[model samples]
Target chain A: MISIKNLSFAYKKKPVFDGLNLQFKAGHVYGLLGKNGTGKSSLLRNIAGLLYPQNGSITVNGFTPFERLPVFLEDVFMVPEEFYLPDISVPDFIKHYAPFYPRFNSEKFRNYIAVFEIPADSTLQNMSYGQKKKVLISFALATNARILLMDEPTNGLDIMSKSQFRKILAEALDEEQCIIISTHQVKDLENLIDRITIIDEGKILFDENVETITKKLSFRFAYDAEDVAAAIYSESSLIGNVIVAPNIDGDEGKLDLELLYKAIITNSEKITKLFQQ
Target chain B: MNQFFSLKRFTLLVLKHWADNKKRYGLSVLAFIGLLITWFVFTMLTGFDNIPMGKAVQQITFFLSLFAVGTFYASQYFRDLGSRSKGINFLLVPASAFEKLLCSLLYSVVLFFIVFTTAFYLIDVLMVAIANSLPGTEKLAGKPNVINVFKVIILRFNSDSTINFLLFFFSVQSAFLLGSVYFEKYSFIKTIICGFVAGFILFCMMYFFYEHLLPNGGFHKGFLTSFRVHVDGVNDHLVQVPRWIGEVFRFLIMYGIAPFLWIVTYFRLKEKQV
Candidate 1:
């Protein structure tokens, strides 16, 4: 679990997070969405203790994240947007690095690597970027850290690797784990993240549980002019004008993340008010 | 299991560092040996007639190789921190800052000296043996046992001065290590520039204060020298720095300088950000 309160972070005079408050609880996969330079990855770095907040504090799993004590670090792992794997074989990397995490499951690591299809003896530098990302993802999951922070994890992955990543992440997660993934590719995370938090202009524009979102908001096509006017957010697709409207009834439909993202971004005030109510 | 300083963790960190850099390090060792052998042979062929293959040449070679390789190693040990890829990997490793800093000291200070000394002697002993094996060259060169060569080099700078010299080497090496952390790129060159600029400024300040401002303080190189100031129509006044102050300066040079630089290096590393 992570808690950030009144966190103000900036780059020199350029501010990023201005008194932003956010929390991530265990047993949920969090999708962090934002436009470029909106502080999504910066938020993840703050939670991972990589970057210190200028004001307030970040608490991860009951410990101050920035202290970076071995015990604190053992329970937290971060896959940076731009990451590095040493110039060593995958097995050698694991051999040299895995001991730091007491709960690291070597078996799980091997299984994840098997699913990713990376060669055991191959040097990491020889692998493609996507391949290296897969290796890093596998290693991160195997660490069994209570909190896992990933930035643009699916950026370099092929279509199939992305799907494989979603599957392994879902399978590897436990109730005690909290995974916060910052990415612009929402489709890669469909049916994966349970909670969505969208940030814009150094503030959390939208944060809600996917289940609660589906329960309160209806994502469907507008039937006519009245429906189009009544809809909170809508866009014209090949079939019709798809809309996101308030679901007053108990009817439940599939959550279209991309559409939901647009709805929240456009009608952020109304949507936020609805959630508050 | 100790968080701050664990012997097990330290050992693991050292091994991990080695594993990460063994290829480059091993190759550097080989290259160092080649360079040493080549330089020795070249110097013997070219300069033997003028300089003579005596204790002086041997001492010069030892000190030259020692400093060249030592500074290079110190400058490069933390060079990985310059790039984000390597820097991130290094910083994120689950080791305390103390452990990480200690690991660097172990490699740059201890292991570098031992390994470089061993390599130098190995090459020197073999080369000296080969040179002596020839009929006429036996008298030309000293016998090539590593211990004898060490004695010759050690005798050149007496033991006390040699210890001070090594301490001074550490002070210089510590500055380079700090530079490796200080500058993101071109750490070696940047460190040299910083040192040169700092030296220039210090020299200027010393000239101004000691020569121009300190009551006619033209440096009289004596234990307790007095300066006579022509105080503009007044009687000439004598100003003397006490012997204790001079001893203080000597003590600082002998003992305080390296530790002070090391502390600065530690704080610099501790404050290092990605």
Candidate 2:
């Protein structure tokens, strides 16, 4: 579990998060969504203990992340958007790095690399960006870290690899682990993430589970004027007008992440009122 | 496991760092060897024409190269911390900050000095053997023997001077080591510039205090003490600080600088972010 309260951070006077409060629980894949410069990456870094908050406290697994104790580090792993791997073979990287994590599973790591189609004998520096990211993702999962924080893990992956990533991530997650992925690309993780957390201007605009979102709101096309009028948010599309309307009858539908993000950003008050009831 | 210090974790960190930098380090050492061989070949060719170079030439070359390249390697010990990609990987490693800093010190100070000395002597012994074997070189230079290079170098000067020189070298290297962490890019050049600026400032201040402020002072010495007298003859005499103070100054110069800079580097690394 990760808990953050009254968190404030800035870079030479440009405040990123002010009095921001948030929490993350285990056994769930959290999809952290936000527009550019909305502090999504910064928030993840703070939670990972990469950045120090000027004010307030952040605790992960009952340990202060900034302390960076071996006990704390062994349980937390972060895959940043831009990462580095040494110019060594995959097995060599494992030999040197895996011992730090007591629970690291080398067999699982090898299996993950095989599933990702990255050759285990290949030199990391010679591989492409997508291959390296896959390797890092594989290593992070294999570490068996309790909390996994990834920033744009799918950035360099091909379409096929993206789906494979989602599939592998879903299978790799243990019941005790907490995973938080921060990305502006929402659709890539649509089916994988169970919770949607939208942040705007350093504050969480909306945070709820997929079950809660689908339970309270219906996302589909409005065929008529009445349907369009009932939508809390709408946008024109090729088939018809896509709408996000209150599910008064407790109906179920796919959660439109893109539309939900747009709704939360443009019509936050109305959406908040809808969820409040 | 103690968070501040752990022998097991420190050893692991050192091994990991070596694994990550094995290629770069290997290449650097090989390059240094190649450079030494080249210098030896060139010196032999040049000095063979007139005075067949003896131990003095070899010693000069050895010490000069040792100071120049050794300091450079020390300064570049933490170069990976300059880039965000590498810096993150380095900082987020499970080892404590103290371990990380100690790893660099181990590489830059202890390992570097030992390796550099060994390599220098290897080339030196080989070159001297070749020179002694050649015709018409026996009378020009001393007979080649496998001499202990460390002893020869230290014995060139008095023990006190040798100790002082070693201390000064360590202090300068420590400053450059700190610069490796303090500057993001061009650390060597920045350290050089800063070093010159600081030296200039210190020299000017010392000159001002001794020359202008002291009013034409002249040294007056006794058996166990010394004093400086003001030309005005108003008994404005300046007494030298106690012998303990001098001893303390010597101790600081001999032992204080490296660890002090190392501690600074540790704190700097702790506050580092990427």
TM-score of each: 0.91, 0.94
For model 2, state the Cα shift of residue A101 in Å. Answer: 0.6
Model 1 per-residue lDDT tens digits across residues B1-274: 7778888878889999988999988999999999988877887777553333445566677887787778878999888778866776776778777888889999999999899888988887777666556466645444433444334435443656566767778888888888888888888889889989999998899777776667653444553355666666477566678888878877887778767876777676656666
Q: What tens digits encode model 2's per-residue C-alpha lDDT throughout B114-164?
A: 888888878778877887777986675355455454555556446565556
Question: lDDT of each model, Cα atoms only?
Answer: 0.83, 0.85
- Cα error of candidate 1 at position B85, Å: 2.7
> In model 1, which runs have C-alpha deviations exceeding 4 angstroms?
B48-53, B134-159, B216-248
Worst 10 residues of 1 chain B by lDDT: B144-153
True contacts kept of each: 0.46, 0.54
Pick the DockQ winner: 2
Task: Determine which window of 10 residues in candidate 1 chain A has minimal summed lDDT.
Answer: A64-73
What are the DockQ scores of the candidates, in order? 0.57, 0.67
lDDT of 2 by residue, A78-163 (tens): 99988999999998999999998889999999989999999889999999999999999999999999999999999999999998
